[model samples]
Target: MSKKVLVTGADGFIGSHLVEELILQGYDVKAFCYYNSFNSWGWLDSFPKSLLDKIEIFTGDVRDPNGVRTAMKGCDMVFHLAALIAIPYSYHSPDSYVDTNIKGTLNIIQAAKDLEIERVLVTSTSEIYGTAQYVPIDEKHPKQPQSPYSASKIGADCMADSFYRSFDMPITIVRPFNTYGPRQSARAIIPTIISQLLNGYEEIKLGDLTPTRDLLFVKDTVKGFIEISKSNFLIGHECNIATNSEISMQKMADTLIHLINPSAKIIQDTDRLRPEKSEVFRLFGDNKKIIEHTNWKVEHTLEQGLQATIDWFSEAENLKQYKAGIYNV
Candidate 1:
C-alpha cells in the first residue's frame, strides 16, 4: 500500500499543488483544509474532478489540537502548511500569527510525537532569515525577524527543532523563498503585478522596488516538498529550496511588463510599503543542502514561471477573483 499522507492547508496555494503532485505520485492523500461556514475548500475547488475525487478532505483549524489529531489519525506522513503568512496582516494582528503559526505548529508536533507518524514536513518561509546578513543565505544564517510573520515562523521552527532533539520526532522543515504561480493571491508581488497589468491599469502601483528577492516557481517548491518527504536522510534538518539567484522589484516589474504589455508604467504606492526598518532588503537562499540530499532541481526558470503565471491570470474566469484596483495586504 502507498503511504497515507495528510496535508494541512491543502486548500491554499502551495498546499493545493502539493496535493496534486502527491496524488500523481500514487500517495493516498488526505487534504486538511480550514473549515468554513460555507464549507468551501478555497483553491481546491479549482482542481480537476478526477484528482479531487481521489483526495480525502478533513476540514478543521490547525489551532485546535483535537482537530489536528483527528485529521492526522492513521496518516503515515504529515505536511503541515497552514499559517497566517501575510507580513502586512501580521503587523496589524500579531496575536493571530502566534496562535496559528507557532501554536498550531506545536499542536502538530505534539500530535506527531504521540502518534509516531513516520515523517512530518513543516512548511517554513525564507522570511525567517529576514534581510540577508550574508549573500546566498544558508540554513546557518542568523535569523532576524523583520516582521511578526517571520518572527512567528522562527518560533515555530524552534519548536519543531526542540521536538526533534528532545522527543526524537522525525521532522523536516522545508523553506521556500518567494513562491509564485497559479492560485497565488495578490498579496504577493508577482500576482499583484500581473493582476494590475491584466486589468489594463495604465500606471502600476507598487511599494519599494529596491529590495531584492529569490523567486521560486510554485511547482519547483512543490517538488522540493515531495523530494524531501521521500528522502529519509533529511529528517530533523532544515533545508531551503531556492534558485540561488536574485532579482530587484524594479527589474521584476520590467520583466512582467515585457511579458504582458510593454506600455505599463510603474508608480510608487506608499501604502504598499512595509515599515522602513522592518522590510527585508534582500533574500537569496543557498540550495546546496537540498540538492546534495535529493535529486531536487530548479525545473522552472524565472521567465518560464512568470509566463505561466501571466497566462493563468490572463483568463477572464481566473482574473475575476482578484480586485485589481486595491493593494492586497
Candidate 2:
C-alpha cells in the first residue's frame, strides 16, 4: 500500500499544489481544508473532478486541537501548512495571527507527538529573516521578525524545534521564499500585478519598489516539500526552497509590465506600502542545504516561471475569480 499522508491547509495556494503533486507521486492523500458553509475548498475546488476523486477531503479549522488530532489519526505523516499569512492584515488583526499561526501550529505538532506520526513537515517562510543582513542566507542566518505575521511564524518554528529537542518527534521546518504562480492571492506582488494588468488598469498600483525578493515558482516549492519528506537528514532541521537569486520590485514590475502591456505604468499606492520597520528589504536565500540533502533543483528560470503564471492567469475563467478593481488587503 502507498504511504498515507495528511496535508493541512490543502485548500490554499501552495497547499493545493502540494496535494496534487503528492497524489501524482502515488501517495494516498488526505486534504484537511478549512471548514466553511459554502462547501468550498478554495483552489482545490478548481481541480478537475478526476483529480479531486483521488483525494480524501476533511474540512476543519486548524485552530481546533481535537480536529487536528482527529485528522492525523490514520495518516503516517502530516504536512502542516495552515496559517494566517498576509503581512498587512496581520498588523490589523494580530491576535488572530497568534491564535492561528502559533496556536494552530502548536496543535499540529502536539498531536503529531502524541500519535507518533512518522514525519511532520511544518511550513516556514523567508519573511522571518526580515532584511537579509548578508547575501545568500543559509539555515544559520539570524531570524528577524519584521512583521506580526513573521513573528507568529517564528514562534511556530521555535515550537516545532522544541518538539524535536524535547520529545524527539520527527519534524522539519520547510521555509520557502516568495512563491508566485496561478491561484496566488492578490495580496502578493506577482498576482497583484498580473491581475491588475490583465484587467487593463490605467496604472499598476504597487508598494515600495526598493525591496528585493528571491522568487520561487510554486511547482518548484511543492517539489521541495516532497524531496524534504523523503530525506531523513532533513528531520529536526530547517531547510529553504529558493532560487538563490534576487530581483528588486521595480525591475520585476517593469518586466511584468513589458510582458503584459508595454503602455502600462506603475504608480505607488500608499495603502500598499509596508511600514518601514516591518518591511523586509532583501531576501536572497541559499539553496545549498536542500540541494546537498535532497534530489531537488530549480527547473524554472524567472522568465519561464513568469510566463507560466501569466498563461494561467490569461484564462478568462481563472481571471474572473479575482476582483482586479478593489485593492485586496
Candidate 3:
C-alpha cells in the first residue's frame, strides 16, 4: 500500500505544488486547506479533475488543534506547511502570525507525537535566517528574525526542536529559500514583477532594490521535501534547500524585465518598502547539508525558473487573476 501523507496548507502556492508532486509520486494524499465560506480551494481548484479526484481534501483552520488532529488521523506521514507568510501583513497583524505559525506548528507536533506518525516534515522559510551574517549561510548560521513572520518561524523552529529533544519524535524541518513558479500569487516578488509586465505596465512599483535572496524553483523545493521525508538519517534535523546563490532585487527585476519587457521601468514605491530595521538585506543559503544527506539536486537553473514563471503569468487567463495596478499587501 502507498504511504498515506497529509499535507497542511495544501491549497497554497508551495503547498499546491508539493501536493501535485506527491500525487504524481503515487502517495495517497490528504490535502488540508483553510476552510472558507465560499468553499474555495485556492490554487488546488486549478488542478485537473482526474488529479483532484485522487486527493482527499480536508478544509479546516490550522489554528484549531482538533481540526489538525482530525486531519492527521490515519495518515502515516505529515507535511506541515500551513502558516501566514507575508512579511508586510505580519507587521500589521503579528498576533495572527504567532497563532498560526507558532501555535499551528505546536499543534502539528503534539498530534504527530500522540499519533506516532512515522515521519513529520515541518516547512520552514529562509526568512528565519534574516540578513546573512556570512556568505552562504548554513544550518549552523545564527537565526536573526528581522520581521514578525521570520520571528514566528524562529519560534516554531524552536518548538519543533523541543519536541525532538523531549520526546524523540521523528521530525525534520525543511527550509527552502525564495521559491518561485506557476500559480504563485502577486504577493511574491517574481509574480509581482511578471504580473505587472504582462498587464502592459511600463513602470513597475517595487521596494528595497538592494536586498538579495537565494531563489529556489518550486520543483526543487518540492524535491527537497520528498528527499528529506524518505531519509531516515535526517530525523530531528533542519535542512536548507537552496542553490547556494544570491540575486539582488534590482538585478532580479532587471532580469525579469529583460525577459518580458525591455521598455519597463522600475519605480520605488514608498508604500511597498519594508521598514528599514525589519528588512532582511541578504539571504544567501548553503545547500551543503541537504545535498550531503539526501539524493536531491537543483534541476532548474535560475534563468530556467524565471522564464517558466514568466511564461505562466503571460497567459491571458493567468494574468487576469492578478490586479497588477495595485500593490498586493
Model 1 residue runs over 4 Å out of place are none
Q: What lDDT would each prediction earn against the true structure?
A: 0.94, 0.95, 0.93
Best by lDDT: 2
User: What lDDT is reached at residue 280 by model 3?
Assistant: 91
Against the true structure, candidate 3 reaches a TM-score of: 0.99
The TM-scores of all predictions, comma-separated, are 0.99, 0.99, 0.99
Stretch of 10 with least lDDT, candidate 2? 320-329
lDDT of 1 by residue, 1-329 (tens): 99999999999999999999999999999999999999999999988898889999999999999999999989999999999999999999999999999999999999998999999999999999989989899999999999999999999999999999999889999999889999997799888999999999989999999999999999999999999988888998999999999999899999999888899899999999999989999999999999999999999999999989989998999999999998889
lDDT tens digits, residue span 206-237, model 2: 89999999999999999999999999999999
With a 3 Å backbone cut-off (N, CA, C), the pairs that clash in candidate 1 are none
Error of 3 at 258 (Å): 0.9
- Counting clashing residue pairs in each candidate, in order, gives 0, 0, 0
